[model samples]
Target: MQDGNTNTPEVETETATDWLTQLKNVIIEYAPAVIAALVILIVGLFVINMVVKLAKRVMEKRGLDATLQKFLGNLLSWTLKILLFVIVASKLGVETTSFAAVIGAAGLAIGLALQGSLSNFAGGVLIMIFKPFKIGDLIEAQGVTGVVKEIQIFTTQLNTPGNKLAIIPNGSLSNGNIINYSAEGILRVDHVIGVSYDADIKQTKEVLMQVMQANDKVLKDPAPTVNVSELADSSVNFAVRPWSTTANYWDVYFKVLEDAKIALDAAGIEIPYPHSVEIHKGE
Candidate 1:
């Protein structure tokens, strides 16, 4: 080998040294940022938890509705965490604008896939803001009549008269008609009673009025009214309207119906029924 071959080995050694120096420089420049990102991540999570807890306490003290409290707390937590994520990403040298664009696109995709769920969420928000119906309120909505058991973020729970639990989407429930029976604290129980046309109209009215008045549950202020509404082909129809507290509505309704029949029988007022007649097959 020629003595000049020593120059080639020297050049190779220098090249290897330069590559290691650049790698070391890169590590030195980024090591602090990596460490800082970790610290922020851990501390940020702890702070987020504390904030959520404090918010819940505040909401409870304010006497906010329980369902609303939970929803607000969750929303606050998610929003804060998203902000923290952006901070952490930026600290680690990620471009904040580009990251946000990616997140936005992903969110758009998810939203498109969950249209109904989003609608229900919006509906729930509207329900909470409007205060249409509360727990234990007897209401009719979406063609189902029941007591409101719960108002959730996406749905409403109803305990039906047949003791069935009905979960209705908030979207439809909010858009549909809702009859809040207990809103005014009082309800009018309407009854259309038919008696034999033979019975005197004045006597029928008196008898029905007495049935409502005798019941302690029926309200006296609004005053019950009995009027002859119509005279059908077979009998005279009386509109028996009784006012009662919402809680006692059903009790008054059922009791009056039974008592009216008893009172009518005592007064010898006839409730007509058709009779059957038969003819011999052969003479």
Candidate 2:
């Protein structure tokens, strides 16, 4: 029984030694490849960062859109990193064909799960290509009127006139109507000024014309119009139309209205107020 116990211990020791020897052989064969892969990974990461930075710089110099610049830069960086990883795996003795098949399957699954995101991505690409409107443009879309702050891959940002920020989906924006107020260099400002029915219609028109002419921002070519548009119960309304550059549209609009009121007041033109007369029969 003692001999049997000693022989079992010897057999266990030999088995342990053989396992260690095989492990050491495997490590010896793969050590160089593993080290190479590590070096490539580190160097590739550094290079990929540099490439992304360089791409951004170039886009900036070329005056590309900020949204497009950021998206393209990130895409290039990710693609290069993925390719680098594949190369590293190959160098480390991984079956590249099987690895690529697994990656393809994962990509397919992700694509299926992100259908909405993919649609938005396609919309973004279409916007970049067609360029219906650009950043800083004042546009009305999706029931929101605002300045375009940014055009992102999945959404667009708008700064509303009320100082509110609106986030709109790119898919809807691309498919919907976008009224760009800033597209045309010039815009027409329309206003209705009312005067008492007793006031002289011709005199009121002259006063309005003078007001528009005095405002230097108003365009001279198209000229300004002052015509009797409506005769109402309380007052006669005149349509005042002026053309101004988009940049100075609001200034011309407000200035003309104020100046017209002052001119009419100085000329003794009456601006009537609302009035009602009530009568009671004898009881």
Candidate 3:
């Protein structure tokens, strides 16, 4: 029994030595491939970065939309990286055909999960193509009104009149109605000024016209108009319409109103306020 057990240990030791030799042989045979894969990975990553940078510069030089430029850059970088990884894996004896199949399956699953994100991306593409509105356009949509600050793949940034920043999803923005106040180069400002019925209608109209004309910001070709719009119990209302450049719309609007009030007052026109008469009777 002692002799048999001693021989068993010897056999076991020989088997262990043989396994180590096989492992060493395998490493020696594949060492060059492993090193090559590492080199390729490192160099490929550097090249991918360079290519992406070049693409970004070209897009910027072409004056592409900032949002589209960024999206394309990211997409290009990711595609190049994936291709490089597959090549490196193939160098190391990985079956890239099967790897590509796995990647395709994963992509499908991810796409299905991100349906909403895909919709927004599609909407952004549509917005870029059609271009109903662009940066710096004062637009009203989705129950919010603001100047377009930036457009992105998923959302749009707006600077509201109150200086608030609003982030709206591109999906809704593309689908909904957009009223671009700045689309037309000019805007018509409408105002109604009321004066006492005793005031001269002709004189009030003339005074309003003078106020509008005095503002150089107001356009002269279209010609501003002041006409009797309504007759109320206390006053006659004159509709004062003036056309001005969109940039100066608000300035012209407020200045014209202020000047009209001043002009009317100077002309001795009375702006009547509501009043009630009280009567006392014996009970």
Candidate 4:
């Protein structure tokens, strides 16, 4: 029994030593490959990052659109990283074809789930290519009016006259009618000046003409027009139409209005106010 017990221990020790030796041999054989895979992954990620930074710098130096530059940069970085991951996985003896198939399936699922977003992205690309409106252009579209602040792949940002920001989907913008108020260099100012019905019509017209003429910003070629537009209950309405450069349209409009009032007041032309009549009966 003692001899059997001692032989049993020796056999167990031999087995344990053999197992250890085999494990060490396996590790020695695969260590270089494992290390190389890790190195490849780390170096590949670093190289991808550098490439992305370089691409972004080039885009910036070229004055590319901010949104487009960022999108492209991110896309390139992700693509390179994914490719590097595949290479590293193959180096580690992973099945690259199976990995690619899985990635393709996931991409298809994501594309289906984000159909609307993809449409907006396509629309944004079209907008960037055609350039219907640029940053700072006052535009009216899809029932919203504002100055374009930024254009992104999925949406566009607008700064409204009331100082609010509006985010509109690019798909909606591309599909809708866009009215660019600033597209034309000149804009027309339409105004109506009402005077007492008994006021001299010719004199009132003369006063309006003088007001338009005195404003330097108003266009001269169009020859500002003052014409009888309506005969109201208590006043004769004259439409004053003037053309001016868009930048000066508002300034000229307000100035012309004030000047017309002053000219009419100086000329003794009465501007009628809304009046109500009162009656009394005695029995």
Candidate 5:
């Protein structure tokens, strides 16, 4: 019984040794190719990193947009790295044709699943190229009105006048009509001023014209127009239109309104307020 047990132990040990020997032989046979593949991967990665850095530096030196620079740099780096990996795999006896087909299939599936994201990405690229709006420009699009803060590959960031941050998808922005208030140097300010129905319309118009002329910021070429637009039940409305530089639009807007009010009061124009009558009846 002891002899049989000893023989059994020796047989197990021999089997283990044979399996290890076969594994080592297989590794040795492919050692050169494995080393070559490893070297290629390491060198390729290093080169790609250097090239990407150089490209980024060049873009920076050119004073390109920050968002565009970052997107381009990352895109180039990822593409080169992926290509290097594929080449390295091929060197290591990997069937590159089958691998590429598999990768393509997977990419197609992912693209189909994330179609919206891909569309946004494409839209972002178009925006970067066309440059309809720049940083700090006040734009209204996609039912959002705000100052453009940052543009990324998928979305644009906006800082609203109310101190709120909004993120809008690039696809929506691209598809919708965009109103860039800052694009033109000048902006037209439109507002209506009301006075009591008994007030003299001629005098009110003259006072408003004087107020507009007094403000130097308001453009004179267009000639400020003050016309009787609507005759409401409580008051007479005058449409006041003035043109001013975009930068000074709000400043001139408020100034004109306030100055017009003071001028109107001095001219004895009465601004009527909404009022209701109350009646009491005996039951």
Candidate 6:
């Protein structure tokens, strides 16, 4: 009985040692595969990025639509990543046939949930392709007038004259009417000046033209014009039109208006104003 008990303890020790040895061997068998899978994952991602960049450069050289270039680049990146993922999974002894199906289903569900975001992305694509307006351009859209500050995948930013930042979704911006004030590089500033009917039309024209010409901001090539536009009951209205670079538009506008007033006053040109006539009755 004493010999049997000693033998049993020895047997138990052997069993425990065998179990540990099996565990170590199992780890040794799989460690290379795991390390190789990791290396491929890292290297594949780097190669995919480089390929995407090359593809974008090629598209740019071909003069393809900027939207298409970006979209294709992103699509290629994901496609390569999915392929790399499947390769790595197969290396790790995971059956990727079913894994790919699982990924597809998950993608479909995510797509359905992000439909609105997809619409905005599509809108951004259209905006980029159509070239309606660009950064630093003055634009009026969606009841707001401002300078375009930035354009992103889902939204656009604008800086208004009030010094406020306005964020507009690309979806609505792409669908709306966009007025690009800076498209022509030059803008027309319109002004209507009313004068007493007795004021000389020719003198008013010359005076207004001189005032516009005196300002440095107004464009001389187009030549500012002054014409008697309306012979109203109380006053004669003169249309003062000036052309200036888009950047200098407001400066020329205000300068012309103020100087014209002062010039008219000095030249004895009477601007019409309403007067309250009083009458006294005696009984």
Name the candidate that leads on TM-score.
1
What RMSD, rounded to one decimal, does every model reach? 4.0, 3.3, 3.3, 4.0, 3.2, 4.1
lDDT per residue, candidate 3, 110-130, as tens digits? 999998888888888888767
lDDT of 6 by residue, 1-283 (tens): 3554565878899999999999999899999999999999999999999999999999999897665677778879999998998999999999888998899899899899998888899899888777899889999999989999988889989999897999998999999999999999999999999999888988889999999988889998898889889988899999999999999988988888999999999999999999999998998
Best by lDDT: 1
- The stretch of ten residues in a row with the least summed lDDT in candidate 5 is 1-10
Model 6 accuracy (lDDT, Cα): 0.91
Instruction: State the lDDT of candidate 5 residue by residue for 56-168, as single tens digits.
Output: 99999988888999999999999998899899989988999999999999999999999999999999998987899999898999888888999989999999879799999
Error of 2 at 33 (Å): 3.7
Candidate 2 structure, TM-score to reference: 0.80
TM-score on alpha carbons, each prediction:
0.87, 0.80, 0.80, 0.75, 0.84, 0.79
lDDT of 1 by residue, 224-264 (tens): 99998998888888899999998898899899999999999
Q: How high is the lDDT of residue 10 in model 4? A: 84
What is residue 188's positional error in candidate 3, in angstroms? Answer: 2.3
Query: What is the alpha-carbon RMSD of candidate 5 to the true structure?
Result: 3.2
- Model 1 worst lDDT window (10 residues): 1-10
Q: Name model 4 segments beyond 4 Å from true.
A: 1-19, 46-50, 57-62, 194-202, 216-237, 244-249, 268-283
* Best of the two (3, 5) by lDDT: 5
In order, candidate lDDTs are: 0.93, 0.90, 0.91, 0.90, 0.92, 0.91
**Model 6: pairs clashing at backbone N, Cα or C within 3 Å:** none
Poorest stretch of ten by lDDT in candidate 6? 1-10
lDDT (tens digit, per residue) of candidate 4 on 8-89: 8788999999999999999999899899999998888888889999999999998877777888888899889889988988
